[model samples]
Each structure stands twice: as C-alpha cells, then as structure tokens.
Target: MDLVITILVLLLVVALSGAVVRILPIRLPLPLLQIATGALLARPFGLHVEFDPGLFFLLFIPPLLFADGWRIPKRELFLLRGPILALAVGLVFFTIVGVGYFVHWLIPTVPLAVAFALAAVLSPTDAVAVTSITGHATIPPRLMHVLSGEALLNDASGLVALQFAVAAELTGHFSLTTAAGDFALTALGGVAAGVFVSAAFGVVRRRLVRWSSEVDPASQVSLLLLMPFAAYLLAEHFGVSGILAAVAAGMTVNFTDVSKGGYVATRVQSVAVWSMVEFTFNGLIFVLLGMQLPGIVGNAKLDLAQAGGGELWYLAAYVAAITLALIVLRFVWVWLSLRFVLMRALHRGEQRPKVGTRLMWTAALAGVRGAITLAGVLSIPLMKAEDVPFPTRDLMIFLATGVILATLLIGAIGLPLSAKKLKLPGEDPRVKEERMARALSAEAALRGIAEEQKRVEETRDEKAIALASRVAARVVGDYQQRLEAAGEEGDVPEKARAEAGTERIMRLAALRAERRELFDLRRSHRINDETLRALIRELDLAEASLTGLHAE
Candidate 1:
C-alpha cells in the first residue's frame, strides 16, 4: 500500500512540476523546479523513498538509454561521427584518469578505485538536460548534434568504466590487459544480445500482427515498452554489458519502424505514450534526488566526523574543485581537437572555416549530467563485503550530485551566452532538404498515377476507365501543386503557390475541427466510440499529409 501510494504521489509530483514550471513568472528548467519540489516534499511533508540500488538501476537506466539511442538523429550522428567519438570515447577515458587522480589527490582517504568510479559517473554528458536549459537558444546545429551523439554513446561507455572500477575495488587488483580483453568481449556480447532479442521480437511481432490482420495498438506499445528491459536482462544474465545491450536495442527501433507506417493509430499512440514515459522517468530521477538531498548532506557530515576528515566547507570545496576541473579538462580537449582538425585540413589544402573559441567554450559548458549520472552514482555498491559499508559511498554520491547541479547551472546560465553572438547560417538547414524530398516524392507519385491510369484504360469498362482517368488527373494535379509549393520545379505562378499554402492551412484547420466534432458527437451520445475513432483516424491521416509540406 505504501509503495503504491509513493508511486502515485511521484507521478502526481511529476505532473504538477510541469504545471508549476509553466505558471512561474521567472523561467526555470523543469528539472531544477522538480528538485526543489522534491526537497519541499521531503523536508516538510516527510516523503521518503526506499531505494534499492539494483532496482533503481534496472527501473530507470535501460529505457532512458534506449530512448536516447532511438531519438538521436542518425543522419547528424553519422556526419558528426568523428567529433562525437572523440568526446564520447576519448574524453571518457581522459576524464576517468584526470578526474580520478584529482579526486584521489583532493581526498587521500578515498581510495583510487572509488575516485575512478565517481569520475566515470561524471564523464557522460546529458544532452537532454542541456536541451531543457538551452531551450531553443540558437546554438549551432552541428554542435547540438555532436552533443546528442556524445550523450548516446557515452552512457554505455561511462557506466562500463564504472563497472570495471567497482570490480577492481572488490578484488583489490587491476590489470589493463585483462580489463581490455574483457571489455571487448562484453561489448561485443552486449551488441549481439541486443540485436538478437530485438530482431527476434520484430520478426515474431510482425508475423503475429499480420496473421491477426489487426492487433491492438495498446498491445503493440506494451511490447515495445518491454523490449529494452528484455535486452538489458538478457545481456546481464550472460555477464555482459547490459547498458550496451539496452542502447543497441534502442537503436534497432529505427529499423523496426519500417513496416509500421501502415498502422497510423499505433504510430500515433506509441509516440505519445513513449514521450510521456521519458518525461516522467526523467522527472522522477531528479525528484528522487531532491527527496534524498537532506539525508545525503547530513549523513555525509556524520561520516566525515567519524573519519576525522574536515568540516562541511571541505565538501563545498571538493565539489567546486571537481566541477572546475571538469570544465577545464573539457575546454582543453575541445580546443586541441579543433586545432588538430584545422591543421590537418590546412595540410590537405582544404579551406574549412576557422573554428571559433566560443564554439569550443560552448562545447565545454554543454557537458550537463542528469538521469544517467544519477543512476550510475546510485548503482555504486552498498557494501564492500558482509556487513561492511562501501567506503565514502555517500560522499562520492554527494560529490557527483554536486557536479550534476553545477553543470546544469552552467548549461542554463552560460551555454546560451556562449552561443548568443555566433553568426553562423543559424537557420535549421533541413527546410531545403525537406523541400527537395517533397518534390522528388511528388514526381514519383505522378509517374505511378500515370502508369495506373494507362493500365486502367486498357483493362477496364468504359465507365471504369473514365473514373480512373478523372481520379488520376485529380491526384496528378495535387502532386504537381505539392511540387510547386515546395518550390523545387520550374517557374510556378506566385498566385498558384499562394493558393497551395492557403489550401493546406485550410484543410488542416478543417481536419482538426472535424476531429473535435467527432469527439463531441461521441460525448453527446450522437455517435459511438468506434465511430468517433474511425472519423478521427481519417482526419489524422489527412492532416499528416499536409503537416510537413510547409516545413512548419
């Protein structure tokens, strides 16, 4: 009963945070607001959650990582692969070493292994949290893409590093060569497991769905929700990287969506459902952090007192120092990386634009940490052995939490300022690409219509042939106008193009009105729920046809 009430309250809090964020006069990031709300809940209202580290990890990490993998723009990911790889893989190792040593040096009592674990948790950037902070603030498109790709890949890499660091601490031994081999084996096995499970599920679902002629959209969404969890569990069962498996499973979702286009209802509902899940899960993470904030501070102080370490001021210094080190380390790496690329370009006689210092700074400051960092810190072992609590576990978690907060503040306050004056093309370049695609699709549609009309003329009765000809002419006219509206074909009249735009707007407006009426009809008992749904679906499809053509 308590568990159920806690969950309900958390969900309510998540929902209320969204509402509260909107009403506040001063704009604040949702995560920050959620954290504050959680603190209020804990201190005054006495909200406390029993957090099992393993359960916390399993419940939160897989789906979030999978969503990152799925949502990462694949085209940008491929284009920015070089820089993304540098940040995600190279920077992770660099942070693990540099930050690990700094952490150990800063506090000698904290073992190197524990420091490394903390550093590893801090390495992965949370682009989603950065997005909330940056909030459509005209950052360069390429930089945003690189940030996103880095977040996607480094979640697996950072967590994997933490896993190894934990193992080293457990056994009191470490070997580079053995760790490398094991890492390779686990990564490969994780990939294989994710691919195998996702592929098998896709094949089975497609066949069953087709055999049934129509499956419930709800059931399809439920299966999709289960997939990442399945992959994570399977990979863990085989003693491999569950993190990688979850990420791979997410990436596979892009390919699996190919045959699903015919199921418009499923597509629409699934997107809505998944978006809500992602938002809720992310909110809960910060809220949970807020809930535990008081205990985390008080407990850390007690532990420090017992160990004769310093006062609470030392904790502040440690967080500040660690956060500064991260920023500096990131700036150095990004600057060197850009310099290397530019030098290489010059040697190759290429004329690439000179990199800006602000871009580098923006990149450095964009390393915000959110849900994955929280998960990694929480996943730290609760005990070293039987009845022995892990050393500095709370302190490390506290430090990590401090970094997460510091980075979020920097991202909220600094990133926009860094990007504000940049005079790059700055427009979303996809408009032109979308136009070109529309024109090409229009040409193909005209050809298909012409071919079908010819076949109908030869193979049908006179009345049927006449109907087919009229239908072809109407559709061909629509496609041709679509091409003209895209402004991709030969000189089209300005008046005709203006008419096309107006026509699309009016059609969409009408469709929306029609959908609302259908819902109202069902509400007023003039129509059944099935009738309402059918009408709404048709309107939705029609609206979809017009939605993206204007690139709006």
Candidate 2:
C-alpha cells in the first residue's frame, strides 16, 4: 500500500510538472523542471525514494529504446551512417580513454580500471535528453537523425565496455584481445537475436490475425508492449548486449505497415499507449534522479572523510573539470571529423551537403547525459570483496550525477540560442512529399470512380448510372482541390491559406456532428452498435485525414 501511494504521488508530480513547464513563460525543458522538483521534494520535505537499478532498467530502458528505433528515420540514419558510427562508437571509446586517464590523474586513489568504469558510465548520451531538446527546435533532419542513431547504438557499446571493466576489476586482471573478441561476439549476437525474435513475433502475429475472426486492437498493442522486454531478456539470457537487442527489435518491426491496413484501432490505441508510457517513464526517471542526490552526496562525503580528505568542494571541482572536459573533447572531435573526414567522404559525390561550424557546435552541445548514465553508475556494485567497498563507487556516482546535470544545463541553454543564431531553415522536404502523395492518392481515387461510372453506364440501370456519375464528379472535384493546394506556385497568399484552414475547421465540425448523431442513434436503438461503430470508424478516419492534411 505504501509503495502504491508513493507511485501515485510520483505520477502526480510528473503530471503537475508537465503542466507547469507548458504554462510557464520561460519555456524551460520538462526534464530540467522535473529534476528540480525532485530535488526540492527530497531536500526540505525529506521525501525518500529508493533507487532500484534492476527494476529501473527493466521498466524504462527497453520501451524507450524500442520507441526510438520504431520512430527513427531509417533513410536518414543510413545516409548519415558514417557520422553516426564516428560518434557512437569512436567518440565513446575516445571519451573512455581520455576521461579515464584524466580521472586517474586527478584522484590517485582511483585505479585506472575503475576510472575507465566511471568513464564508461558517463559515455553514452541519453536519447530522452536528445529528443526533448531537438523536438521543439528547427535543427536539420540529418543532424537529428545522426544524434538519435548515435544515442541508440552507443548505449550498447558503453554498457559492454562497462561490463568488461567491471569484470577486469573483480578479477584483478585485464586482457585486450579477449575483450575485443567478447565485444564482437556480444554485439553481433545481440543483432542476430533481435532479428530472430522480431521475425518470430511478426509471424505469430500474422498467424493470429489470419486465424481469428477479429483480433482486438488492445490485445495486439499489449503484445507489442511486451516485445521490447522479451527481446532484452532473451539477449541477456544468451550473454549478449540486451540494449542492442531491444533497439534492433524495434527497428525490425515495421509498425507503419500495420497501421496502414485494417488495423485502425491498433494504430490509434498504440500511439496513445506508447505516448503515455514515454511521458510517465521519462518524467519519473528524471525526478527520481534528483531525489538520489542526498544519498549520493552523503556517501561520497563519508568515503572522502575516511580517506582523510572530506572537502566536498574538491569533489565538486573534480566533477566540474570532468564535465568541462567532456564538452570540450566532444566539440573538438566533431569539428575535426567534419572538417577532415566527412568533407572528404562527401567530395566523391555531386551535390553533397556540407556540415558547417554552427551545426558542429549544435551537435557538441546536444550531448546531454541523463537516465542511462545514472543507471550505469548505480549498477556498480557496492563491494569488490568481503567487507571491502568497491573502490571509488561513491565518488563515481557523484561525478556521474554531476555530469548529467551539467550537460542538461548546457544543452537546455545552448541548443535553442544556437539554432536561432544560425537562422536554420524550418522547411522540411518530407512535408512537401507527403502533400504530393496525398494529391496522387486523390487523383487515383478519381480515376477509379470514372472507371466504375463507365461500367455502370454500360449496364443501362438509370439510377445506378446517375449515382456513379455523381460520385465521379465529387471525386474529380476533390482531386482538383488537393492538387491545387499542393501546387508549386511562386507564393500562396496568406488569405488563401487562412480560408483553406477555416474550411477544414468547418468540415471537422460537421464530421463531429455526424459522429454525435450516430452515437445518439445507437443509444436510442435506431441503429445497432455494430452499425454505429462502422460509421464512427469511417468518420474517425475522415477526421484524421483532414487533421493531418493541414497540420504544420
């Protein structure tokens, strides 16, 4: 009961923080606000929230990664694969080497292996942080794609590095050749596992759909929600990288096709379900991050005191130095890579897009660390041997938390200002492509109507011929209107766009009225529930199409 109450209270805080962020004039990011709220609750109010690393990983990480993989633009990810690999794998290893040595030099008490462990903890950028910062900004799509892809893949690499570091520390030995082999095996195995699992699930789902009279959308969505967890657990059971498995599973299962078929309810319900899950899970993670501060700080202080130096300021300075190093290193690496590597690669092709200085800075600043870092740090065991605490565990957590906070602060402040300063264009080519696709679809529908009208005319049924003609006329009119709206004119007058918007609003109002009337008819037994549902589904689809058509 207490646990239940605590959960309810945390959810309430998440909801309230979401509302506050939107309502406030300052336009603070939601993660920053939620973390502050957690800190406040923990400090003055003595609100204690225990950290369970296992449970956290099980509940939050899989779904988050799955959703990212599902929604990521696959084409852009492939196009920017070079940079994504550079950042995700190359930069992560670079940070581990650079920060590992830096930490060892700063704190002689910390061993090199343990230093690498700390570096590994701080290496992977959080997807939540990246998405939240980029979602509202007008950054280029390719940049966003690279960032998203890097975040998704680097989690697995960093965690795998951490696993090796931890094992070396425990065994009092390290082997480079063995580590390399293990990394390859785990990473490759993870990918294979993900592909196998996703394919099996897809086959099963299709079979179920084929055999069943009607598969409930809610049940199908429930199965989908389980997929990430299943993939993760299966890969883990085989001693592979579970994080990568979850990501691969998500990318493998193409929900877009499923959503386009007769599974309208599944599409609609799944969107709402996943959206709610992301909101609640991400909110609680950040808030709980803040709540962990008191315990982390106190532990670090106690450990330092035992080591004969209890200067909290010293630890703060150390965290600050490492945080600064992360930012500076990332900036330099990205700039050099763009200047030397990416430019040369692009020179091979005509009409290649060039990366500018501003874009490099944006990418560098966007490396905000969040939940995954904390999870990695906390998962570090408390002791190495009987009655002996893990070396520098407390300090590592303290520094990891500091890095998370520092990066978030830098990203939240820097991203938008840089975007505005760069005068980045907001136009998306995909929007134009979508409009063209809709116009073509409308044209196809018109052609189908015309063909049907010709067939009806040959039948010599007067009523049917008249109905066919009327439908064909309506289809032609709709097609023309859509094609005109999608035209590449010199400019569309603002007044015309306004009128089109107003017309859409009026059409939506009429659709809603028709739905309400159908509901009333069903209630009055003038129509059966099945008839009402079928009509409502049509209305819902119509409204969705109209809403999507005009949405910016």
The lDDT leader among the candidates is 1
Deviation (Å) of 283 in candidate 1: 1.2
Query: Residue by residue across 349-461, what tens digits does model 1's lDDT show?
Result: 99966777887888899999888998899888889899988888888888988998888887889988887877678346666677779779999998899888888888868
TM-score of 2: 0.89
Q: lDDT value for candidate 2? A: 0.81
In model 1, state the lDDT of residue 414.
94
**Poorest lDDT segment (10 consecutive residues) of candidate 2:** 488-497
User: Once superposed on the true structure, which residue ranges of model 2 sit more than 4 Å away at CA?
Assistant: 134-137, 255-257, 307-310, 342-354, 423-426, 451-460, 490-499, 509-545, 549-552
Question: Residue 264, candidate 2: how far off, in angstroms?
Answer: 1.3
Model 2, range 377-429, lDDT digits (tens) per residue? Answer: 77887778999878878888888988888888778888877765665555676
